[model samples]
Target: MRNHYLVIFILGLLLSGCVTVQLPGGKVTSAKDVEYKQPAGAFKEIASADADKSWISANTGNTISYFSECGGKSEPTLKDLENDAFAALNESKTLSSEEVNYNERAARQSRASGKLDGVPVELALIVFQKNGCNYTLTYGGLAKSFSAEAAAFEEFKNNFKAP
Candidate 1:
């Protein structure tokens, strides 16, 4: 009887070790595959100082919008834009100004360590304002799986225009 009990205990341990934790929706998929479809009329281009040079693109998926003001008297320099972007992130409780990269002009990069929807999440905000234009990029997702989203964020930034 003792041997039988020991065998059962060993089997329980082995089964426990093999157990895998699964989310409620079965196997989890990539956030990129989740399709962050922008709403109809979600983004509109408004004219800036230059013809189609300054504009703002609204990203509803991430609950944020990007504005680029190039070739205008109000056009913000890289430093000013970075400060504004960091401030915005802080407003959303996504990141703190000190946690993000503030000095880098070419790519002001910063990460906010936190969680969203019970998943480990990191928010990365990148701002690049130059030549009378400012670009604000933001992405949030699993901390370990941010590369793809980060690239998408950069692409969105690159598509900035003056309205």
Candidate 2:
């Protein structure tokens, strides 16, 4: 059973269509064929785990994480990932959360705002499937500065080109 699970995980990663990201002119690569919008403040690349990818902003303690949850007999929807994203926030730290444009957009984009561990945060999550791979772009940051950061993320999402 363990080996079976391991094989499934490996196959999932393989079928997920992972790709090496290139920083073109200091631009951050979201995914394969996905566009990147230069953010306002300086952000440093942080080490990522084997599965989920992550980054952090310099000025603010904002962090963005990219997760690809695809590759099975059945595929998951953006709304499903959006709910999972919200549930991901530590419930103990979450003060309040409400949907902010949590509707079906062009690419199933969703937004939510809340307080996490005494820090205000805004979450912008986009779920998309491209090139037989499902992807989710999650952006979390200080709510006080969320507007500006959200603008940057919005620009990036706008330029997203799926292969």
Candidate 3:
């Protein structure tokens, strides 16, 4: 009947709407897999040697890591960096929470622990920022299985050069 044909057509249209085309390899692409290119000449290196000196002085006696990337220029002070790092660690639901303290000198101390490879390890990360520069010195344990992270941080700091 005409009604039956209309019903069949409507059903076919609805089913076609839900159909998804699979790629030749049966792989589904996700939006997150898309690559984004960094804008050219985006990051400039800090020019002052004194900035590096300040970072080194503030981060003594701690294993720290340094990473610099070409990005925005909203330079944060040592206090701001310390506070931000602490806030990030505090907000992590995976780690066991603990009290953290920071001094006026922009020194930080905290203890936290979490699972690593089915084993438990304690972690301590300290941060120091100096002279309101773009650099932040961070010392932390990735896991209790390894030793101090300060040496790695020192190596990273030593590699800083004005671009």
**TM-scores for all candidates?**
0.35, 0.60, 0.30
Most lDDT-accurate candidate = 2
Best by TM-score: 2
Q: Per-residue lDDT of 1-163 in model 2, one digit per residue for the tens?
A: 3433233233222222234343343332334544455444555555554335455566555555555533334445545555655653343233343333321233566666654543445666676666545676666665675565656566555654445
Per residue, candidate 3 scores C-alpha lDDT tens digits across 1-163 of: 3433233222212211212234354442211221222111212222232122112111111222332222323444444443444433322322333333332343444444433333333333444433332233333333432244334534443443322
Candidates by lDDT, descending order: 2, 1, 3
Better of 1 and 3 by lDDT: 1
The TM-score obtained by model 2 is: 0.60
lDDT of 2 at 144: 70
Each model's lDDT comes to 0.37, 0.50, 0.32
- Model 2 has a clash total of 1
Evaluate residue 108 in candidate 3 and report its C-alpha lDDT on the 0 to 100 scale. Answer: 44
